[model samples]
Target: MIVVTTPTGRIGRHVLGHVLDGAEKVRVIVRDPERLPAPVRERVDVVRGSHDDPGVVAEALAGAGSVFWLIPPNPRAQSVQDHVIDFVRPLCTAIGDHGVERVVAVSTLGRGITRNAGLVSATYAMDDLIESTGVHYRSLCPPAFMENLLSQVETIRSRGTFFAPISADRRFLTCAVRDIAATAAALLLDGSWTGQDSVPIVGPDLLSYEEMAQIMTEVLQRPVRFQQISGEAFTAALRRAGVSEAWAGGGAAIMAATDRGTYVAEAGSPGPTAPTSFRQWCEEVLEPAVG
Candidate 1:
């Protein structure tokens, strides 16, 4: 049996689809079962509750051979690291108690760096908490998600400009969520039971925001330009979007770190080959959003 958390999300849904083919039993933990896609909700056992609920997590992990674990960022968290550790520690304990053998956690690149990375700090905490359980674990660490660009689609469509704090020409590694999900599914199904491992899933090539804008413009048949915003401007924009001051500040700091190469991913790590290119992702996913 395999259990997946956050299964309604982009990466989790893909991983669930990939693993459902041959698995005798598959389960998904969701806050609200009714919100899941009809097909997915029907095919898998649904554990209704958040990952913070120990009883729910234990039930989800019961008799499960493998678990795909991911914690969505909470902008409202008092202390992001504490909130993450609070959830992960008990959940890992529950999974262990339930005799779950393997855990595949979704983390991010640049997680080990001690300073200048805000959210990555929390992910590093999660990795450590999961490792202490002594369960066979694999941490899927990918660079910036290409799907994050989707949030700027409206700006591209209406203003013909996509804005970010990073330098438009500074190259950074980027990976598609689908690629991350596929790699994670492979790890779960392979049953290697590697004790503790961190895998960096990089893209075929490094790209800058300007390069990404070019590809997106070509795919959508619109003139799109990358505009570099000041960290202050970025933070204000996030604040206007209803993000809390603390989270907005943290987000701006992370973007600034990326601009300075502090968040740059290391050159190589052992993981699956890049599955999709920026052009491919834009053509297959981004173009449809414009329509």
Candidate 2:
């Protein structure tokens, strides 16, 4: 049996879809089972409650051979570190009790190099805590998501401008969430691999926000451009967008670190690289969001 957390979310739903396409026995932990599409409802068993709840996870993981885990964002939480760790503590016990054989989790980049990286640091902590359980684990590490651009879709369409806290010319590698989901789905289906490892889901292009704007301009037929903002201003913007003050401040810290080149991919990767290109993401994802 395979258990999936956050099964209705953007990436998780896709993971569930790919797994369901195969012959694995599947169950899902969801806050609201009704949010699942009707077809998904008919196909899978579900435990309705937050996955972090001990009972929910225990019930979901019962007799399950593999687990696809994702910590759903809590933008309103008072503390980023506490939020992620608190959720993981329960699951660590459950994984041990259930004797699950394999685990796949979504984590971030900058594992060893990034310090005081706010939420990213918390994700690294999560990896440590889960791995200590001795479950065969795979950490799906991706940099900034290409879907983040969708947050600026309205501005890109109406004003042809988007905002960022990072400088225009600093290059960073990003991955499409589709690629991340694809990796998770593939791992969940294969029970042969053992031990712990990090899978870096890096897209093929290294791009700056300026290059991203140029691509969006060409793909969406709009003169999109990046406008840099102050760190505090970016935090305030995040708050205005509905994230709590603490979460927004952590986000600001991540932006500051990114601008300082803390997130630049190593000259040659030491892990797996995904196949999607930045321009391909623009044409497929950004263009549709703009429309």
Candidate 3:
């Protein structure tokens, strides 16, 4: 059986769908079973609780061979590092106790660049903790999510503008969540690969926010613009939106690292590059969200 965590989340739901289509016996650990579609609940073994709980994870991993892991964000958590550790420790223990063979997890790019990055650094730490367990692991590393723009959909619709902490001309890789999920599902369904490695799920396009604005303008047929803001201002905006101080500060650190080009793929890097271009993502995903 293949166990899936966060089965109703944006990327997890897609991963679960693909796994089911591959005819894998699936089990899901979820906090609220009702949140899942009725058909999904009927299809998988439902362990109704947070995966961070030892009992919950132990129950979910019983007789499971492979797993899809993702840590859901907690905006109100006191510290980002502590929050990540709380979730990872239990899984590390359960992986050994249950004798699971392979694991696939959602992680960020930039492994060797620096450690001062908030979420990026924390996720890299997670990779290490899981690897220390000596199980077969694949870290699905991707840059910024294009769906992050959905947070500003209302602003784009009303003001024809979106804001970011990066420079207007600073280009970076961004991947669609669907592509990330597709890669994860493929790894989970196949049992051939072994050992540990990181897969960079980079999009085919390297785009700046200004260029993204141009594409949005054409795709949405609106006069959209990109407004560059200071990292402090971006953090403050997140704080005002009611996230904890640590969460807000982490957001700033991520943008600061992005501005430093931490997510840029290395020259001739191996592994699969995602095929979704920015223009195609805009036309298909962003335009629909804006509408």
Candidate 4:
């Protein structure tokens, strides 16, 4: 059986869909069964509860051989690291208890950097904790998500301006979540690979927020601009928007590390697992969202 956590989430939903296309038995751990699409609800075994709960995880993992693990984003969590640990600890215990053979998890880049990159560091910690259990694991490491720009769709449409905490010219790879899901689903279905590895889902372009804005301008036929904000300002904005202090600080850290060139694609690493380009993403995703 293949068990998927966060099956209704932005990335998870896509992962679930791709996995369901295969012939394997699929089960989902979700907080609310109603959130699942009607057709999807008809197909999989639904264990209705947060994956963060031990009982719920154990219940879902019973007779399951492979697991798709994703920590649902929690902007109001008191502590980012602790929030990740809360979910991962149960799964680690369950992996040992259930003898689950494989784990495919969504993690971020910046695996070995010395500086503290809040959410990135949290994901690294999660990798370590899960690896300690010795389950065959694949960490899907993608850089900044292109869909993150969708959050500024309103501002981009109304004011032709979007904001970021990084420098305007800082080049970094950005990935599409669909690409991440494709990689996860392929791994889940084949189940031929072994012990542990990090799958880098990098997009084709190495771009800056400024280049992205330019692409938006050409694609959307308007003058969209990139506005750079300080990390402090970024965190303060998140706080003002009701995100908890810890999560907001983590956001700042991610941006800070990005600006410091922490997420640059390394030499001779595998080619872009996430093949979506910035222009393609703008034309396909951002343009539709703007409309």
Candidate 5:
């Protein structure tokens, strides 16, 4: 049996779709079952409760051989550390007690760095907690998600511009969430070998915001430019979008880190290579936005 948390999310949904055909016993932990798509809700066993609920975790883990775990960020969280610890502690204990052997956790590339990557600090702590349980664990340390680029679609359509704190020419590693989900699904289904492993999933190529803008414009057949914004402006924009101050500050910190090259993965790291490119993603996913 395999249990998935955050099954409605981007990566989780992909993971679920990848495994649903092969696995006979697949379950999803969802807070509200009614919110699930009809096909998804009908196909899997739905455990109606929060992943952080001990009883729910135990139930979800019962007789499960593998689990795909992802901790969603709480934008309203007062302190990031406190929110993460509170959420992970119980799930770790439940996994330990419930005899679930293998876990694939979604994390980010800059989690190990101490100076920057403020929000990723929580994922690093989660990796530690999951490792302590003596379960076979794989922590996926992926670079910037290409899906984040979707946020700019409306702006590009209306204003012919994508705004970000990242410099237009600053090259960075970015991977599609689909690739991350595929990697996690492969590990869960195979379950061949794992003790404690951190895989830095990188895209086939490194790209800059300017290059991305060009690709978007070509794919969408519209003129789009990358507009770099100040850190203060970025934070204010996030706050205006109703994101909490802590989350906005953390986002600003991450952008600053990106500017300093802290988010770039080391060359030749031992991890899976994702085949998707920014241009391909734009053609397949982002082009639909303008339609």
Candidate 6:
């Protein structure tokens, strides 16, 4: 049996779909089984609770061979590092107790390219803790999610503008969440790989906000503009959007790092690059969100 965590989340749902179709006996640890689609609920064994719980994880991992892992964001937690560590410790214990064969997890870029990046640093630390458990692991490290652009749909539709902390001239790296899920599903279905490693799931395009604005304009058939905001302003915006101060500050710090070119999309990633281009993502994801 294969176990999946966060099965109703964006990437998790997609991973579950692939696993279910692959005809693997699938089990999922979810807080609310009702959130799962009717078909999904009927198809898999469900442990109804958050994966961070020791009992919940132990129950889910029982008799499971491979696991798809993802730590859902806890923006309101007091400290990002503590939140992730608290969530991971139980999984570490469970992994050993259950003797899970292989694990795949969602992670971020800039492992060695940059240091002291708030959220990035915390997530890297989370990966380190999981790897120390000696479970065969694959950390799917991707740049900022292209889906983040979904948040700007209203602004793009109304004012023809969107905001970012990065400067217009700086080329930013991004990854489609679809690619992340696809890669994770591929890993989980296959049983051949061993040892520990990281896969960079960055998309092929390297774009500046200005260039992205141009593409959005062309794709949407409406004028669009890039508006660069200060780190403080971005942090405040995130705080207003209900991100905890610490995490919002970390997000701002990450933006500052990216703005400075700390992760230039090609620094530490030497593995498989995702096939989706920014334009394709915009056409497929952003345009639909805008509509």
What lDDT does each candidate get?
Answer: 0.82, 0.88, 0.92, 0.90, 0.83, 0.88
The regions of model 2 sitting more than 4 angstroms off are 268-272
| TM-score against truth, every candidate | 0.94, 0.97, 0.98, 0.98, 0.94, 0.96
Q: Global CA lDDT of candidate 3, please?
A: 0.92
Please give the ranking of all candidate structures by lDDT, highest first, separated by commas: 3, 4, 2, 6, 5, 1
lDDT agreement of model 5 with the native: 0.83
Worst 10 residues of 5 by lDDT: 263-272
TM-score, structure 2 vs. true: 0.97
Number of the predicted model whose lDDT against the real structure is largest: 3
Compared with the true structure, what per-residue lDDT tens digits does model 2 show for residues 72-144? 8899999999999988987899998998899999998778888887888899999999999999999999988
Encode model 4's per-residue lDDT on 166-242: one tens digit a residue: 99999887899999999999999987889998888888888888888888999999999999988888999899999
What is candidate 5's lDDT per residue for 1-291, written digit by digit as tens? 888888888899899988887755789999988878899898899999888788888888888889999988777777777777776887788877888889998988865564656677667888889898888999998878988877876888898898889898998888899999999888888767868888878887677899988888788888989999999999999889888888888888888888877655465443438889888888887888666
Model 1 regions lying over 4 Å from their true place = 262-272
Query: Scored by Cα lDDT, where does model 6 land?
Result: 0.88
Off by over 4 Å in 3: 266-272
Model 5 spans > 4 angstroms off: 265-272
Residue pairs with backbone atoms closer than 3 Å in model 1 (clashes): none
**Model 4 — TM-score against the truth?**
0.98
Q: Which ten residues in a row have the lowest lDDT in candidate 3?
A: 263-272
Task: Tell me the lDDT of model 2 at 174.
Answer: 87
lDDT of 1 at 177: 95
Q: Write the per-residue lDDT of candidate 1 for residues 15-123, one digit (tens) a residue.
A: 9888887655888899989878797777999999998788889888888999899887777666666767877976788866888888998987776554656676677
